[model samples]
Target: MIEVKNIEKSFGGNKILKGISTVFETGKTNLIIGQSGSGKTVLLKSLLGIHTPESGTISFDGRIYSELNPDEKRELRTEIGMVFQGSALFDSMTVAENVGFPLRMFTKDNNKKIQERVDFVLKRVDLTEAHKKLPSEISGGMQKRVAIARAIVNNPKYLFCDEPNSGLDPNTAILIDNLIREITEEYNITTVINTHDMNSVMEIGEKILFLKDGLKAWEGNKEEIFRTDNEAVVAFVYSSNLFKKVREAYLKE
Candidate 1:
């Protein structure tokens, strides 16, 4: 599990996160959602140590990141697996190489071990035959799968996914969300995903953080979103046609 306590972030003079406190539970999909310019992005980066929180404590399991030294920080980083907004795969590398990159860099394992791990992850993501293809050779959804394989190849305890479903059709997006949620539950990893997609929220939002500007306006599960009386959350929920239909269906039932 990941625990974030009293997190505050600022840039020059603009404060971003305003005393945000939340616990991302293990073996569940924890979503951070908000409109554009909300603090969700900053919160994700803050958890990853990409952005330093001025007055917050982020701990993985029990170890606080702010208290770690350089070496310790690097060690902590190794335990984190990230699927970036765009797959972020190297265009030049084949699918196999991209999936195996972490093992090659982080461990002294030989070729046999690396290939075994790589193939295992690829099969786990259902991309066994695509390894020989370059990232550009695959479709957008396939590229995201490759990215997922790479993220899990290292067997990370923490998984961070930033817009994992961006630029894909709704059908493909749902597939990716389910895949992520399944992996999180199966591995019992503390997974944090930052996204604004309402479908994703309804599908796998076991725990959610709703951010507005720089503050956490609401926090709850998918069902709670519709039942809440918070104005900001109400606006966010009803604004999207998809969620409007969802709210209607829930109300009618």
Candidate 2:
């Protein structure tokens, strides 16, 4: 589990995160949803240690991030896995090489061990046949799968996905969402995903944090989202007529 308390981040003149506090539980999907300028990306980056918060602390499991020494910080980074928004795979590397990159970079493991782990994760993501393919050679959805396989190849304890379903068809997007949720449960990893897709929310949102204007407007599960009277959440989530009908139908039942 990851615990964030009173996190605040700012640029020279503009503040991005404003004293946000939340706990992302292990073995479940925790989603951060907001508008484009609502500071979701900054919050995600802070959790990833890309940006240091001016106030408050971020703790992974039980260790405070600010207290970690240099070596310990490096080790903690190895335990954290990131799936970038753009399926950020190296175009030149084959799927096998990409999946094995973390092991090669972070561990002294031999070729046989690396290959074994790579094969295992590829099979886990249903990409065994694409081991020899390059990122450009595969479809977008396949590339996303490869990215996910790489993120988990090291058996990370914390998984952070930023728009994991970006640039894919709705069917493919749903498949990726289910895949991430399944991996989180199977590995018992603390999974945090930042997204703007409402379909993803209603589909796999075990815990949802709704942000508006750099503040947490509401926090709850999908069922609660439908039943809540919070105007911010209602306006943002049911902005479309289709979803309004869906929420109405859900509440009726």
Candidate 3:
């Protein structure tokens, strides 16, 4: 589990996150959703240790991040895995190499050991046949799968995804969402995803945090979101006529 307590961040005169406090439970898909300038990205970056908050503490499973020593911090980072937007795989490397890159960098494992681990993760993600394919040689969905394979190859305890379904078709997006959820449950990894996709929220949102203008406007699950009387969540989530009608139908039921 990851805990953020009174996290406040700013850039020059612009305050991005305002004393936000939340807990992301382990073995569940935790989602952070907000508008363009609502500060979800800033919060995600803070969790990733990219931008340190001026005040507040981020604790990963009870270890205070800011207070960790240099060596301790480095060790903590080794347990983290990140999947950036747009499936940021190395175009020059094959799928097997991409998945094995972390092992090469962080472990003393030999080539045979690395290959065995790579093959295991590839099979886990159902990409056993695409090991020799380069990033450019595969389709978008396959690229994202490759990215996921690489992220988990090192057996990370936490996984962070930024706009994971960004450019994929709806069907493919659903597939990716399901895959992430399944992996989180299977490995009990604390998974946090930053997304603007409402479909994903309703699909895999075990815990949802809704941000508005830097503060947590509301926090709840998919079922609670539908019944929420919070104006901010309602306006942001039911902005479309289709969703509005769906909400109405649910409330009527």
Candidate 4:
């Protein structure tokens, strides 16, 4: 689990995160959702140690991030896995090589052991046959699967996905959402996702944090979104005609 306590961050005197506090539970999909300038990205980056908060604390499990030593912080980073917004796979590397990159960079494991782990993760993501293929040679969905395989190849305890379903057909997007949720549950990883995709929210949003203008406007689960009377959440989530209809149907039931 990850815990946040009254964290504040600013840039060039523009406060981006203002006293944000929340807990992201383990073995569930915790999502941060908001408009383009709502500060979700900054919050995500802070959690990843890319930005330093001026106040408050972020704790993983029981260890506080701000208190960790340099070596300890580096060790903690090794336990994290991140999937970038654009399916950030190396263009020149094959799927297997990309998946094994972490192991080679972080561990003294032999080539055979790394290969075995790479093969296992590739199979887990159902990309066994794509091991030798370059990113350009496969479909976008396949590339996403390869990214996921690489993210998990090191057996990370925390998984962070930034818009994992970006630039895909609706069907493929749903598949990727399901795949992430499944892996989160299967490994009991503390998974956090920063996304604007409402379909992802309805499908796998076990925990939802709604932000507006750098503040947490509301927090709840998928079903609670429909029942919520919070104007900020309602206006943001039901902005589209499709979701408005879906909310109406859900309330009727």
Candidate 5:
């Protein structure tokens, strides 16, 4: 699990996160959602140790990020897996090579062991037959699968995805959401996602954090969203006619 306590961050005197506090539970999909300038991305980066918050603390399991030594911090990074917004696969490398990149960089395991692990993760993501294909030759969905395989190749304790469903059709987006949730449960990893996709919010949002103007305006689960009376949340979540109708039907039921 990850815990954030009153964490605040600023850039050039413009504060992006304002005393945000929340707990991201393990073995579940925790999502950070908000408007474009709401600071979700800044908060996500703070959790990853990429940004130094001026105050408060971020703890993973029991270790406080700010207190870790340099070497210890490096070790902590090895236990993290990140899936970028763009899939971020290398165009020149084959799918298997991309998946095995982390293992080669961080572990001293020989080529044979690396290959075995790569094969296992590829199969886990259902990309067994695409091992030899480069990112340029595969569909966008396939590239995402490859990115997921790479993220998990090291068996990280924490998984962070930045808009994992971005740039995909609705059908493909749902598939990716289900895949991420399944892997989170199967591995019991502390998974956190930064996303603006409402479909993803409803689909796998076991725990949801809603931010507005650099502050945490609300936090709850998928079901609670429909029941929430918070004006900002309602306005943002039901902005579209389709979701408004869905929420109406849910409340009616």
Candidate 6:
């Protein structure tokens, strides 16, 4: 689990995150959602230790991230996995190589051991037959799968995805969300996602944090979000034409 307590940050003189606090539970999907410049990005980065909070505390499991020394920070780094916005797979590397890259970089295992790890993760993500394929040779969804396999191959305690479904068709986006949810539950990893997709919100939002500007405006699960009386959240939720239509139907019922 990860916890952010009374977090604050500033860039130049502008405060990016202000007194933000939330708990991201393990073995569940934790979503941070907001519009552009709403500080969700800053909060995500801060939790990842990419941006140090000006005055606050971030703890991964039980380790206080704000106070870690260099070696300890490196140890913490190895415990977390990140899936970037894009697939971020190496175009030149085959799928097997990409998924096994972490083991190669971090472990001193022999070729057989490496191959075994690679094959295990490949099959885990259902990409067993595509091991020889390059990133360009696979579909976007497959590329995301390969990225996920790579992210988990090292057996991280934490998993972070930055817009894991961005730039995908709606159907493909949902498929990716389901895959992430399944993996998170199976591995019991502390998973956090940065997104603006409402479909994802309703689909895998075991824990949701609603950020407006910098502060956390609200927090709840998927069920409570729709009935929230907060004006900002309602506007954000029903602003989409699709959601607006659904809201109308539900009210008429």
lDDT (0 to 1) per candidate:
0.92, 0.93, 0.95, 0.94, 0.94, 0.90
List the candidates' TM-scores in order: 0.97, 0.98, 0.97, 0.97, 0.98, 0.94
Model 6: what TM-score? 0.94
The lowest-lDDT stretch of 10 consecutive residues in candidate 4 is: 123-132
Please identify model 1 stretches exceeding 4 Å from their true place: none
Which lDDT tens digits does candidate 5 get at residues 1-253? 9999999999999999999999999999999999999999999999999999999999999999999999999999999999999999988899999999999999999999999999999999888899899899998888888999999999999999999989998898998899999999999999999999999999999999999999999999999999999999999999999999999999999
Candidate 5 least-lDDT 10 residues: 125-134
Worst window of 10 by summed lDDT in candidate 1: 237-246
Clashing pairs in 1: none
Clashes of 6: 0
**After aligning candidate 2 to the native by TM-score, how far in Å is the CA of 185 from where it should be?**
0.6
Report the alpha-carbon TM-score of model 3 versus the true structure. Answer: 0.97
Tens-digit lDDT string for candidate 6 (216-250)? 99999887786678898989988989887876676
Estimate the lDDT of model 2: 0.93
Return whichever of 1 and 4 wins on lDDT.
4
Estimate the Cα RMSD of every predicted model relative to the unseen true structure.
1.0, 0.9, 1.1, 1.0, 0.9, 1.6
lDDT of 3 by residue, 1-253 (tens): 9999999999997999999999999999999999999999999999999999999999999999999998999899889988888888988999999999999999999999999999998998888899999999999988888899999999999999999999999999999999999999999999999999999998999999999999999999989999999999999999999899988998999
The TM-score measured for candidate 5 stands at 0.98
Q: Which stretches of candidate 4 lie over 4 Å from their true place?
A: none
Which residue pairs clash within candidate 3?
Answer: none
Tens-digit lDDT track of model 1 for 69-159: 9999999999999999989999889999999999999999999999999998899888879989999899999999999999999999999
